[model samples]
Target: MTDRTLTVITHVDDPSIGVLEAAAADNSWSMTMVAPFRGDPLPGVADLDALVVLGGPQSAYEVQDHPYLSDEIAYLREAHAHEVPVLALCLGSQLLADALGGRSRPGDNGLECGFIDVTATDPESLLNGTFFSFHSDSADPPPDAEVLARSDRYLQAWRTGRSTAVQFHPELDGPGIEALLALEGAKLRQFGVDVDAIRESIPTSGPQPGRRLLDTWLDDVPVRDPAHH
Candidate 1:
C-alpha cells in the first residue's frame, strides 16, 4: 500500500471528479488519468490499486459510435473478474453494469436531471439525501451486486465484489454543475427540464462535509494481489 496508485477514466473535461480527488489525496493515492474521448490509451486494470470511471454524456451503449468504450468495458470485466476495486460514476457505472452481464439503456421514467434525494439502504444515509444527477439511463445490477442506494426513479448505487457503481454525481459541485448546464441546458430543455428550476435547486452554499461519500468507498478498496490477476 506504500505506492498506492489509482486510475481515473474521464470522458469529458467538465464533470471531472472534483471532491473524489481530495479523497484520493487524503490517502496520498496517486491518480493516472485516461480519456477515451481524447483517444488516451486505457491502462491495464491489474496494474493499479483501483479503477475509477468518471461520468460522461455518452451512453454506455454508445460503443459503436465511441468504440474505445468497448475497450473500457473489457477492462472493467477484467478488473471485476480479478477482484480489483472499481468506483464507476454515472456513464462509467453503466459500463460496469454491462461488464457485469447487465446493461444501461434509456428508461421510460424520463430524465433525472438535478439535485435529488437518494435513499441509502445499506449503511443508510447519515447525511442529507440529495446528490446531483444529470442522466436518463438506468441499470440492472448483476445477480450478486448489492443495491446500496436508489431514488424513486433509478438505481443510484450498487456494488459487486470490490466494484461499486453510482449513477449520481457526488463528485460535482457548484461550478461543475454550472459548466454542465452551460453545455447541455438546451438539450435538457428539449427533454422537459426547467433550467431555472434546476438552478434554484442547487444549494446556495457549499455542501456538507459528507457530500462526497466516495471517501468511504475508497477507504475500503482491498489491496491488490499480484496473483489475483
Candidate 2:
C-alpha cells in the first residue's frame, strides 16, 4: 500500500477532475476515484491518508431520491469516527455537515451561484481567501464544527476535528471553471448568471496557492496511528 493514498468520492462527472488529478500528480500521491454511480466504495478506507468528497447536483436531504447518498454518508461518518483527514466541497460539504449532526436545509438566500468572496474567520486555517461557489442549499453546522468562513450567500466553510468542509470549489482552476460553464451554461443562464461575468471572476492562474493552504491544514492535523483506534 502507498504511504500517501487519498480516496476521492464524487458523483457523476465533474470538470474539476483534471485539476485534482494534476494536484495528486504534483504531490506524488496515489488516488482512487470512487464514483457513487458505479457502486464502488473504498476498499480499505481506514488505511487512507486523506479523503476527498466532491460536489454533486443533489442535496444532502435527498437521500430518498438517491440511495447511494445513504451509503456515502455512512462511509463519511466512519471516516470521521476514525479521525481521517477529509476535505469536502459543495454538496459533499453539506453531506459532511449532516453526517456530523448538522442540518442541511434550503439556503435562505436561494442559490449561491457564480464567484463570490469568502471572508476568513480563522486565518490560521486552510481557507483564507476567496473561493468559487455554486450551490442551491446551505447548512447549519453541528456543535462540534467550527465556522471558519462566511459569505453573503451561505456558510462558506466549516470544520469539525480533522474534517474540513467548504461550500466552495477551491480545487477548480480557470480551465476547470470554463469547462463547467460550457457544460452548465444553460442552467447558469437560467439563474441570471452572465457567462462573461463568471469568466471574468475566475482568476487566470493555477491552484498551487490553494493547495498550499490545504497542505498547511493537513500539517496541523494529527496523523492517526492504526493502533490508537
Candidate 3:
C-alpha cells in the first residue's frame, strides 16, 4: 500500500475535524493538522500527497486583518501549480477562488446560516445534492473554474482545474452543528433567526449523506504516483 499524508489548515476547533479524521482513517491516509497562524510552512508541500484547507470566521478578502490569509492562499496556489490534489472548505474555498484570480464578495442578500439545499450545476459527480452552509460571503469562480453547484444564497461550490472548493460544511455532524448553533447564537439572533426553526431544519441524524459524498470525492481525487515526485 502506498502511504499518503494530507495536510489540513485550520484556525478554529471545529467539529468537522473529527469527521475529516474519521474519513482519512477509513481511507488509510494519515493527516497532519497545521495552523498557518501558528505553524511554519512545510519545506515542500509538493511532497505531500493531498491538501485540505479548512474553514475559519475570517473572510478571504480581509488580507489586512489576517495576513496569514495571503500566505495560505499563496501556499494553495503553489500546491495547485504543482498539480497536487486539493479540497478547500468554506473560507478556504473562497481563498482558493481568490488565489486563482477570482473574487469573493460579501453577499447582497445576507448571511446563509443554516442547512441549505444546493443544486448540482454540472454532472461532475463529486457534488450532487444539499450541503450545510454557514458563510456570509460568496465567491465567483475564477475564469478557468468550472461551477459544480449553486444555491439561492450564494455560489455553493466550484472546481478549477485540479482543485475543488465548496462553500458548505460537509464535515459537520450532529454535535458539531449543535456547537455551531450555540456559538453563533447571537449572530443568528441578530439576523432574526429562530433557534428552534434552525434546529428543526437540521436533521436529527446529522449529515451522513454529505459524508457519503465526501467519501466518493476522496475516491475520485487523482492520486499522484510517488515516483513522479
Candidate 4:
C-alpha cells in the first residue's frame, strides 16, 4: 500500500530539501511540492496528509513584498484548526509563528547564517545537535506553544498542536549550501558575514542532520493513516 502524502511548500528553488524526499520514501510516503515563487497555487488542507514549509530568503513579516505569504499563513492557520500536522523551517517557521499569534524579525545579534548547535528542551527534540542555520530572523512562540529548543539568541524550535517549527534550516545539504553561496555569497560578504566559516562548517553539517530531522518528524509527529495503494 502506498503511504500518505506530504505536501511541501517552497518559497524559492534553492531551498528544496532532499532529506524530506528521502524520509518520505523511507516512511512509505509520497510528496507533492508547491512553489509560490513559481506562482504555484497553494493547496488546501484536505489535499495534504501533512505539510512542510521550507526556508527562503524572504522575511516572514514582509507580506507587502511577498503577498502570497499572507495566504500561506492563512492556509497554515486553517490547517492547524483542522489538526493537520505541520513542519516548518526558517522563514516558514517565522510564518508559522505569525499564524499562531507569535512573531519573528531580524535579530539584533545579526544574521545566523551557517551551522549552529542548540539547546533542546527534551531528549526527543529535532534540535538535539548541530544543524544548519541561514537566516537573519528569530521566532517568538505564542503563549501556548511548546518551545522545544533555543539558540543563544532566540527560540530555535517550538510546537503547537500538530505543528512543529524551527528557526534553523535542517533541510539543507551540500548542493543547498552551494546554491546559497552562488545566490547570496557576495551579498552576504558585503553584509560582513563570514563566508569562510560558513564554507568550513558545510562539511561537518552535511545532510545527516536534515535527514535526521525528517526521520524524527516522521517518527514522532502525529499523521493521518496512509491510504491503500
Candidate 5:
C-alpha cells in the first residue's frame, strides 16, 4: 500500500491519461509510463498495482503494420489472467477485446467523434454520461463480459473479471480533446465531422462524468502483495 504503482501503456503521445494524473496524485499512486510506439519495453504486469492502456489513432486490426500490437495483446492477456485491474480506453479497449476472445473491427456506424452521451445498459453499472470519443473502430466484447454501457452507435464500455474496457475516453478533458483535434482535425473533416464546431462546442465546465467514472474504477482496484503474486 505504501508504493501503489499504476502502469500506463500509451500507444501515442497525444492521449496520455488527462484527468487521471490528478487522480493518481490525490490517491498517492506512483505511475510508470510505457510507450510501445516509441519502442519502450513493457514492464511486466506483476509490477503493477493497476494498469491503464490509452487511446491511439492506430486501428487494432493492423497488426501486420504494427507488430508491437501483438506484443501488447499478449501482455494484456497476461494481465487479464492475473486478475490485474485494467482501465482500457478507445484503441486499448479494442486490443483488450482482441486478446480476450472478442473482436475489434471498423465501425458499421462510421466515426463516433466529439462528445457523445453514453447510457448505462446494465442497471447496476457505475458508468454512464458524456465522454469524449474519436474513433472509427469498435469492439464487440468477449461473450462473458458484462456489457455495461453503450452509445447509440456502438458499445461504449464493458467489464470482464477485473478489467473494464471503454471505447470512449474517460481521461480526456477540454485541453486534451483540443490537442487530439489539433492532431487529426483535418482528417475528421473529410468524414463530415465539423472539427471547428466540435472545438466551439468544447465544454468549459471541465471533465465530469468521465472523472466520476474513473474514480469509481480507482476505488475498485485491488491492492496486492508483491510476494503473493
Candidate 6:
C-alpha cells in the first residue's frame, strides 16, 4: 500500500501567500488553487484535506460589486459543515465568519496596515507574534467560536471546530508586503500614511514565524475524517 499525498485547496484573492505555499510543501501537501475573483470555480470539500482562503482588497459586504464574495461565503459554509479544516486570513477571515453567522463590516477604528503585535488569549499560542496586517474591515467571529488572539485595535485570531482564522498576514514576507502596499498606495496616501515608514518597519523575522504558525495548524488542528486526496 502506498500513502497518498494530502491535497490542500487554496482560494487566492491575492497571490501573496508564498510563505503558506512553502509551509504546505514542507508538510508534503499538494496544492490545488482556485481564484473565484478571477472566475475560477470552487471545488467540493468532501475530497479535500484542507481549505485555505487568502486575503483580498474587497470588503465582505460588497457582494453587489464582487458577486463572487457570495459564492465564497456559501462555499466556506459548506466546507465547515463537512468538517474540513479551513485556514482563513484577513478578508478571508471575514467571509468565513459571515458564512458561520458572524458579521463583517468596515473597521470603526479604520485601516490597520503594517506590522502590529497581537495578544494571544493563551500565553503560549502559536498565533501569538508580531504579524504584518492590512485591512480596512473587521469581523466579529461567530458567537460560538473561541477567540484566540487580538490586538489593542482589532480582533486578530479565532477558531471553531477544525477551522482557524487570523486577521493578520502571516503568509507575507517583506516583498509581498511591499506588493500589497503598492496595490493600496492611493488609499494609504489618502489616509495620510507615510508609505516609507511602513516600508522601514517590515520585520526581518517575518516568514520564519509565519511558517511556524502554519506548522502548528497542520499538526494540531483535528481532522474529522481522512480526506480522499
lDDT of 2 by residue, 134-153 (tens): 78898899788888889876
Q: Give TM per candidate.
A: 0.90, 0.90, 0.91, 0.90, 0.94, 0.89
| Candidate 6 residue spans exceeding 4 A from truth | 1-14, 205-207, 221-229
Go through the candidates in order and give each one's C-alpha lDDT: 0.81, 0.77, 0.78, 0.80, 0.85, 0.80
How badly does each model clash, as a count of residue pairs? 0, 0, 0, 0, 0, 0
Top candidate, metric TM-score: 5
Tens digit per residue, CA lDDT, model 1, 84-179: 888898999999999998887886588999888888895555323887888888888788888888888888888888888888888776667777
Instruction: Give me the runs in candidate 1 sitting further than 4 Å from their true place.
Output: 1-3, 123-128, 204-210, 227-229
Name the TM-score of candidate 5: 0.94
Question: In candidate 5, what are the lDDT values of residues 159-212, reduced to their tens digit?
Answer: 899988999887877788888898888889889998998888777885554787
> Lowest summed lDDT over 10 consecutive residues: which window, candidate 3?
11-20
Residue pairs that clash (backbone atoms under 3 angstroms), model 6: none
Question: By lDDT, who's the top model here?
Answer: 5
After best superposition, candidate 3 residue 8: deviation in angstroms? Answer: 0.6
Which prediction has more favorable lDDT, 1 or 3? 1
lDDT of 4 by residue, 1-229 (tens): 4478888998876455766777888888888889886889987676578899988878998999989999899988998887788998888999998998998777777877777888899977657888778777877787799989987866788999989998887777666776787688898898888887877767645356778777878776555644510
Q: Give the runs in model 2 whose Cα sits over 4 Å from its true position.
A: 123-126, 206-209, 218-224
Q: Positional deviation of 137 in candidate 4, in angstroms?
A: 1.6
Instruction: Compose the digit string of candidate 3's lDDT tens values, residues 71-188.
Output: 9888888888888878899988989988898988787778887777788876666466766678888788799888878887678778877798988888776667778888889878
Single out the weakest 10-residue window by summed lDDT for candidate 5. 206-215
Measured with C-alpha atoms, the lDDT of residue 191 in candidate 2 is: 82
Higher-ranked by lDDT: 3 or 6: 6
Per-residue error (Å), model 4, residue 144: 0.6
